[model samples]
Target chain A: MTVKLYDLAHSRAGDKGNTLTLSLIPYNADDYELLRVRVTAEAVRHHLRDIVAGEVTRYELPNLPALQFVCQQALTGGVTTSLTMDTHGKSLSYALLEMKIER
Target chain B: MNERIRIGCGAGFSGDRLEPALVLLQQANLDYLVLECLAERTIALAQKRKRQNPPLGYDPLLERRIELLLPDLIARNVRLITNMGAANPLAAAEKICGIARRLNLSITVAAITGDDVFHLLSGDEKALETGQPLTASGPLVSANAYLGADAILPALATKANIIITGRVADPSLFLTPLMHEFGWLPDNADQMGQGTVIGHLLECAGQLTGGYFADPGMDVPGRKNVPDLAHLGHPFADILPDGTATFGKVAGTGGLLTLATAKEQLLYEVMDPSRYLTPDVVADFTQVRLEEVGPNQVRVSGGRGQAAPGTLKVSVGYDAGFVGEGEISYAGSKAVGRAQLAGAIIQERLRDRFPDLRVDYIGSTSVHRTSFGEYPDPYEIRLRVAGKASTASMAALVGEEVEALYTNGPAGGGGARKYVHELVGIVSTLMDRRTITPQLTLFQS
Candidate 1:
C-alpha cells in the first residue's frame, strides 16, 4: 500500500532560512564533495521552530535527477500504539493513525 | 478502558544477580509483564548459539522464569511481552509453547519477526556494514534489525498471554502493548509522546521516581543503595489519558523515584534529545518536562516531536582503537582530588609517550559520565583513560601508570590494580529509505 508521510520539517522545507540544511554530492564523489542546498527565505520561515539556522552561509545544491528530502530532526514509530512514545520521540498511537501506512 | 493498567517489566541487565527482577513482579502485583535484555554484545552471543550443531539461539530465560511465575501471572491474568528472543525467535516460541503445555495454561505466545534485516544483506554482505551503497565486514556473525512497537501490535492483538520479540526498540516494550490494549495508533503522537515519556521514565527501572534520587529527607543510601542490596522497589508510572504520565516506586520499595533520579535516567546513553529516536519512534527530548508531583512520584510529560524520516539508520561498530581502564586510589587528605591528579598524570604520560594516543576518563570523572546528558553529578571523582590511534598501546601503557601512582604521588597508600581491556571500534551504518517500511508479524504457537 502507498501512503504519504510527512518528511521531517527541515527535510520538507529544503535549505533556506531554517537551521536544518541538506546537501548533495556526485554518486562517485568522496564524503568531502557533499554540497549544501540553499533554501529560500520563505522556506526558512516555514521551518523556523522545527529547526535552527546553521552558522555558516550555505550554497544551494540543486537535484538533477530526483528531489531528495533529508530529515534533520528525528522521527520514528511508523505505526504502533501506546500511552508510550517510540524511540524517535513520536507516539506510535498518534503516528499510526496519522501516518498512512499501507499494510 | 481508560482505567490505569499497571505493567511490570521482567529481566534486567543482569540475570545472575539481584533476586531476579522477574520474581519481584509477582509481589508488586502488576497488570502486564515485560522482560528486556538486548545489547549489542548479546547479538554476538546469540550468534554463537546459532552456530551450534542444533543451531539454537539465545536461552529462553524469560520463559523459564515465567514457568515459576506462571501460576501467579495466570491467577492475576497479567499479559506479558519481551525481547528475550535475541536471534531465533521461532525457536523461542517452541520453548515457550512446551512450558505452556506442561502447566496446562492456555497461553497465546506471539513471535514478532521480519526485523532480522541483516539476513537480507547476505548476497551483498559489504552493503550491510558501512550501509553504504557497497561495503563489507570480516564475517557475518550476527545481524538483527531494531524493530518498532507497531510490529508487536499484531502479536498483542492475538489476545496472547505473552508476546516475545527479538531486538525490539527498548521503549517499544512498554509502548506496544499499551497501544494494543488502548487501540491507539500512528496518529497519536501526543499519546505516543506520553508513552515515550513513560518509557523514558521507566527505562532504567527504579532510576526515576527515586531509585537514584538522593533525597536527604528520604533516608536513602548513597551509591551503595543505587542498586539497593536490601529490598529493591518496583517503580510504577500512572499515565493519564490527557497525554501526561506520572511515575514512582511501588509503595515500600527501597529506592526513590524523584525528579533528580528521573532526570538522570532520561539522558542515559542518549546522543540527541530533539529526535530521541528509538527503534519504535523518534521521541523529542528537547521539550520534555519533569516535576516532582509527590514525595516519590514524578510527572513526566511535554516532549514535543517532529515527523520521523522514511529511513531508519543502523549503527555497526568496527575496529578503531584500544580502550583500557585502570583505577588507583590515593587515601590521604585530598584523596579524591589526588586521584583526579594522578588520573591526569597517567593520561598525560600516556599521551606524551604516544602523542597520538587519545585519552579520557569514565565514571564520575569524565564529561560523558551518564548515559544521556540530562543529569549532573557532584560525586567523588573516578578516573579512566581511553587511547585511540593505530600506534597507541593504551592497555600496556596505562598499566604502567597504575604501578607508578604509589611512588609519584604524596604518601597516600596506593595499591596495585587491574585494567579491563576493551577494544575500540568505529560504529558505522546507514539507513535505506526503501527498506524503512514498517512490518507487523503475529505467530501462533
Candidate 2:
C-alpha cells in the first residue's frame, strides 16, 4: 500500500546560510526501520528536486529514531537575502512531507 | 550552590512575546532566565543602526523589556542573560541599568563586548560554504564571532543581576550559567555536552513548550487543541550535578511539555547530531533521551560529546542588494486563470529589467515552488511578484510593474501591496578561536 510521508512521520525545518536542515521522526517507533530503508539521500534529493539545488546529506540517529537531512543551496539565499515570503524556509518541512511513500 | 540549577528561557527570538517570559519569572521560580534574541542577520542590521547613532546599536526593545521586567526581576532575584544587546552590549547594559534606576530598584548589569571582530577581518576572508570571498558581495557592514560560554563566564562570575552580550551562540547564553553554577570547567566535555543538549532544547523558548507543535492527527493526539494558546507558558529545566535534566512549564499555564514536544525541539535546527558544533563543545545530541516523566514534564539525559572546535564561526554581513515585492489578491470565478495571466504579463513586462523576477500564486503554488504535478484549482489566489536588484529604485520596479496589472493586464486584481527593502546579506566564516577575546563591562544602578 502507498501512503503520504506525512502519514508516517512528523518533521520540522531550520536554516543556516543557504542550507536547510529538516529532521524527521516517525510517529510510530516501529516504522523507523521502514523509513530508514526507503528515505535515502538520493530519494530525498529527487523528492525535493524543485527546492534543493545542490547536495542533500542524510544523517541517521538510531537512538532518537530520527532522520536529519542537510540540504545545501536549499534557502535560495539565507535569511539576509531571500526573495521568498518564507525566508527561513520554515515551510520546507511540509514540502518534504508532501512526498508519497510506499508503506 | 544548589544541586540542580533551574533555568528558564524567556524570549526565543528578538520579537518573541513578553507575557510568557513574565509567567516564567513569576511562577517558575527560576534561578536564571536566558533570552536568546539575536539571529545571524540581526547583528549586521544592528551594526548599521549603531553606525547611524553611536549609542543606539542595541535592540530597540531593550528598554521596554527591561522596564517591564525589572521590578519583578529584582523582587524575584532571578539573574538575566540575554543577547538582546545585538550590535552593542555596552549600551544595552547601560540601558538596562537605567531601566532599573527608573524602577527604583538596585541591580548590577554586566555587558560582554568584543564579539564584533570586523576590524580583525581581512578583506580576502572567504565564506565557509562556497569558499568565495565575502567582500565579493559588497562592502562589509558587520562581522561578529559566535562567542561561547567562555566569553560569558567572567561576567556570570560577577553575580550581576543582568548580563548582556552581542553575537554569542543561543546555547552559550544558557550554558554559561550552567558552567558558572556547576563550576564545570570548559574542558569538561561530558558535562558541557549534556548541558548543551539542555540549552539547545530550551533555546527556542516557547517552541519547547508546544507553541509550534499544534498538528493534531489520528496518530498524534492532544496537540491541536493546545489549551489556552494565548497563555501558553514557556519552559524551564532543572539540571542535576549528575547530568540528568527535567523540563517542565509552570503549573496551570497553557501548553504541553511532553516528550513529543521535547523530541521535536531536540533536533530543531541541528544538522549532525554526532558533531553539533558550538564554540564550547562538539555536542553529541544523538544519544540524548527524552521521556515523559509526568504530565507536562519530560526528563532528558544520556547526552555525550567531544572537545570544542579550535575555530569559531563568524557571521559576516554585507549589503547584497535590495528586494522588491508586490502582492495582489484575485477573487471569485476564474481567479487562478486571472492570477496566471497576471503573472505572465508582469514577467513579460519586467523581462528586460528583472530577468530573474519571481511570480508565486499564494493560495496554491507559493511555498513549495512546484506543486508535484498539478494542484487543485482555487477559488481565490494572491499573486506575488518579487526580484532582487542592485539599487532600491531598481528593486522598486518589480512591485511597480505588478501593481500595473490592475488596469494594464489582468482583470479583478485588488488589495495590492508593494514593498522595497535594502537586503542584508549574511555569510559565515571561521576564525582561529585564540585570536578573538571577550571583554566584560559592569554597570550598577
Candidate 3:
C-alpha cells in the first residue's frame, strides 16, 4: 500500500551554510530497514529537485533507525542571505515527509 | 563532589521564554544552568551595536533574565553559564555584577573573552567552501572562532557564580561544567565527545522535551499527545563520571521526553555521524544509544570521539546588500488562481529591476513545493514575493511591485505588507587554534 512518508516517519531540518540536513526517523523500529531500502538519496533528490539545486547524500544509523540526508546547495545563500521567509529551511522537513512510500 | 551532576538549560536562544527557566530553577535541583543565546550572525549584530555604544553589546534580555532568576539561583546555589554576552563579555559581566549589587547578593561573575579574532584575522584568509579570500566577501564586520571548553575551564575553576562568554561553541557552555566537575582532561576525546552529545541534545532546550517534537498523530511512541507548549518545560541532563547521561525534564512540566525525541535531537544539524566536529572534540554519534529508562527520561550513552580538529571554525560576517519582501492575501472563490495571477503580475512588473525575484503561494506550495502535487482551491492564499539587491531602493522595488498588484492585477487581494532590511552574510573559515588565546576576567558583587 502506498502511504505518505509522514505516516511512516518523522524528521527535523537544520542548515549550515547552503546545505540543509534532514533527519528521517521511522515511527516503528521494524520500519527502519524498509525505509532504508526505499528512501534512497536519489529518490529524495528527485522529490526535492524543485527546491534543491545540488546533490543529496544519505547516511544511515541503524542504532537509531534513522537516515540523515544532507542536501547541498539547498538554501539560496542560507540564513544570512536567503530571500525566502523560511531562510533556515526549518519547514523543509515536511517536504521530505510528503514523499510517498510503499507500506 | 556528587558522582552525578545535573545540568539544566535555562534558555535555548536569546529570545526564548524566561518563565520556563524560572520554573527550572525553582523546581529542578541542578548544579549548572546554561543559556545558549548566540547564533552564527548574532555576534555580528552585537558587534554593530557595540560599535554604536561600547557598553551595549550584550543581549537585551540579560537584565530581565538575571532579575527573574537571580535570587532563586543565589538561594539554591546553582551556577549560571551563558554566551549571552554576545560581542561584549566584559560589559555583560559588569552589568551582571551591577544587578547583583543592587539586589544585595554576593556573586562572582567571570567573563571569558578571546573568541573575537577580528583584529587577528587578515583580509587574505580564504573561506572554507568558496575558496574566496575574506576581502572579496564584502567588508568584514566581525569574525569569532568557536572556542572549546578549555577557554571556559579557568573561569569555572575560580568557582564563579555566573560565567559569561562571547562566541564559544554552543556545546562548550554545557561541557565546561562537566569538565570542571569531573576534572576531565582537555584531550579526553571520548569524554568530551560524550559531553558534546549531551550538550547537543540539551542545547535546543525544549526541542527534545516535545517543544519541537510533537506532531499530533505523526510523532512516534508517546509524543502523539498534544503538548502544552505555552508552558513547555526546559531540559536537563544527569551526567555520570563514565560519560553516560540521562535526559529529563521537571516533573509536572508541560513536555514529554521519549526515545524518539532523543533520537531526533541526537542527529539534529549533524552532517556526519562519524565525524561531528566541534571545537572540543570530533564526536561520533553513530554508536550512540537511546533507551527510555522511565517516563519522560531517556538514557543516552556510547558516544565515541577522536582528536579535536587542529583548526577552529570561524564565523565571519560581512555586508550582503539588502532584502525586500511583500505579501498579500487572496481568499474566497478561486483564491489559489487569484494568488497565482498576483504572483504573475509582480513577476512581469518587476522583471527588469528584480531579475531574481521569487514568488511563493504560502497556502499551497511555498513550503513543501508541489511534492504532494496540487491541492484543492484553498479558502485563502497569501502571495509573497521577495528579492535581494545591492541597495535599499533597488530591494524596495520587489515589494513595491507586489503592492501595485492591489489595483493593477488580481481581484480579491487584500492586507498587503512590505518590508526591507539590510542583510549580513556569514561565511566559515579555519584558523590555527594556537594563535587565539582565551582570557578570563573576574568580577565580584
How do the predictions measure up, each by TM-score? 0.60, 0.98, 0.97
Q: What tens digits encode model 2's per-residue C-alpha lDDT throughout B1-445?
A: 6698899998899899987888889988889988888988888999999999999899878887887788888899989999999999998888887777887888999999889999999869888866889888788899999999999999877869999999998888888888888788888898889989999998999998888877756455643447777788999999887779999999988888876677879888888889889999999987888888898899999878799999999998898889899999999999999999999888888889887788899988788787888577888999999999999999998889888888887789999999998878888889999999999999998
Residue B171 error, candidate 1, Å: 1.3
Candidate 2 per-residue C-alpha lDDT over A6-34 given as tens digits, one digit per residue, 9 for 90 to 100: 88888889988888999888877899899
**What is the lDDT for A41 in model 2?**
88
Better of 1 and 2 by DockQ: 2
Off by over 4 Å in 2: B216-225
Specify the CAPRI tier of model 2: medium
Candidate 2 residue-wise lDDT at B180: 85
TM-score of 1: 0.60
Please give me the DockQ of candidate 3 compared with the native complex: 0.69
How big is the positional error of residue B41 in model 1, measured in Å on the Cα after superposition?
A: 3.0
Query: Which candidate do you rate higher for DockQ, 2 or 3?
Result: 2
For the predicted complex of model 1, DockQ is 0.02
- A best-first ranking of the candidates according to their DockQ comes to 2, 3, 1
Which residue pairs in candidate 2 collide? none
* Least accurate 10 contiguous residues by lDDT in model 1 chain B: B365-374
Tens digits of lDDT, candidate 3, B110-226: 999999999998879998768999879899999999999989999988969999999999988988899989888878899989999999999989888987776666445453563
Which is better, 1 or 2, measured by lDDT?
A: 2
Give the residue spans of candidate 1 off by over 4 A.
A1-103, B11-24, B53-55, B59-64, B122-140, B212-229, B315-428, B433-445
lDDT for predicted candidate 3 compared with the true structure: 0.89
